[model samples]
Target: MSPKILVVLSSHDKLGDTGKQTGWYLPEFAHPYYKLEGKADMTIISPKGGAAPLDPSSVEMFKEDAEASKFLKEKEALWTNTDKLSNYLGKADQYDGIFYVGGHGPMFDLATDSDSQQLIKEFYEAGKVTSAVCHGPAAFVNVKLSDGSYLVKDQEITAFTNTEEDQVGLSSAMPFMLETKLQENGAKIVKADQPWGVKVVQSGKGGKLITGQNPASAAGIGEAILAAL
Candidate 1:
């Protein structure tokens, strides 16, 4: 059977107290979906399992990318009706991997949702590929392995960096610094040369942990997941 991939998104739409709207970044999902579509069966899910909101800026960014536009027009059903994160916590064995699409939103819900934490732990401990891009790595903040150690402990990873967060002007608005939290949890973090640079990390052959630096790393991370699978 083709590998089954679970794509997780954040249902939260508010961007801190800034009063701005946010959710999953469109191309982060669109780029990866298109790249993984034929190779794997993907199910998009959120904490509440309804229409996952799109970051307004990402929607605008989609206009310049043909792949993202194609996904928007043709793949609405997948993202519109997602499964509940609660429904897959114990049953994650059905999925060969999980991919988290980033946006300012994940920093709110996915970062601290108990169910999301449990699910990430399940996938990681099961030796299944666990991939996240940009703020998607927010989901890793509180995940603990079966042995009670952080899943990211001693792992080399990357996410939306502190500098990039400040560059995007959301530094003060986030609940916490994503890169700092990952570092606190013992991740040997590496960053790219600049804000939008692509940085995809795949541990080793058949390695289960995969992460991308920012939006620019989405497609590259998707390809890494395929190879890991």
Candidate 2:
């Protein structure tokens, strides 16, 4: 059977108080979608069940990249009207894995969303291939095991770092630094050698909690998830 993968995206569109638009980053979703296209069956979804917004800056930034550009032209439906995350609360077992795609939007919504927290807990407890990239790990912040421990606790993974957030000049606008929050949750983050470079990390526990550091690492994140699946 082709592995069924659930791709969760953030539905929030406002970027703090900057009057800027932000949601899922284009490459974060695009790169991974193409990588897994023939290998898995993907269902795109979000908290609100439709129109998961894209970060405008990300769209412009990746506009010149052929793969991202192609995705923008060809995959409108995937991000346009998504299935609601709440609809799959009890159906996680149907999926081989769950991927949380990110932008600044995830930091605001998915990070603290109760539904996201519960769903991630279900996937993690079931030993499914749970994964996220960049700010995507924000979704993991509140997922807890039956034992009441954070799923990410003591897990070695990576996400968009504090330095990277600061470099982007939105650190102050963020609720909290992702790296710091993950650390507080007991996640042992593995940093990339340089900023804006590809870096993917497999979780310390049997490599299930795969994560990537930034936009440049999205494709690597996809490759890693495919291998895990």
Candidate 3:
């Protein structure tokens, strides 16, 4: 049987108070999805279970990329029919890996979700590869490992950087910055020079923990998770 991988997405709806643009980006989820689809039985899940938002800006970024554009159009059903995190937490062991795709949405909802934290801890302790990209790593802040420490503690990982956040003008809107919090939790964070650069970091000899720098690295992140599996 093919390995099953849980792809966690955020259900956050608002980008900022203006509500101008918000949602998961096409490349962030679609690029990884296509890469993993052939290798694993992929399951997409979300915090609230249905209709995850998509950041409007993401659509513009991939407007010229055909594969990304196609995937974005077909993703409506998947987004609208996603399973709630609670539903998957009960059967966390059924999967071989867990991947979190990101946009600005994750910093708001995925960070504080108790179910998300529990599911991440369970999958990690069960020896499944745990991976995330961009702002997706924000969810790791609250995940407590079996050893009573943060899962990211002492782990080498990467995520959306403060510089990128500032460039996007979302620094003040975020509940907390990912890079600072990950470092505070003991992660050795590595980031790319630019947010759109492709960068993936696997912290530990076994490559058990993985994180990608931004949307451009989603394919690399997916490949890394597949390799670890």
Report how far residue 20 has shifted in candidate 1, in Å.
0.9
Over 44-128, each residue of candidate 3 has an lDDT whose tens digit, in order, gives 8999987788887888878998778888787677777898888887576788889998898888889999999999888888878
Ten-residue region with minimum lDDT total, candidate 3: 15-24
lDDT of 1 by residue, 97-187 (tens): 9999999999999988999999988888788999999999999978888899987888888899999999888899999999999999999
Per-prediction CA RMSD (Å): 1.3, 0.8, 1.5
Candidate 3 lands at a TM-score of 0.95
Tens-place lDDT digits, model 2, residues 69-167: 999999999999999999999787888999999899999999999998999888887888899999999999778889999888989878999889989
All candidates: TM-score: 0.96, 0.98, 0.95
219, model 3: CA deviation in Å?
1.3
lDDT of 1 at 113: 96
Q: Give candidate 3 regions above 4 Å deviation.
A: 193-195
Flag clash pairs in model 1: none
Candidate 1 ranges beyond 4 A from true positions: none
Tell me how far the alpha carbon of residue 155 in candidate 2 is from the true structure, in angstroms, after superposition: 0.5
Which candidate should be chosen as best, given lDDT against the real structure? 2
Cα misplacement distance, residue 28 of candidate 2 (Å): 0.4
After best superposition, candidate 3 residue 61: deviation in angstroms?
Answer: 2.1
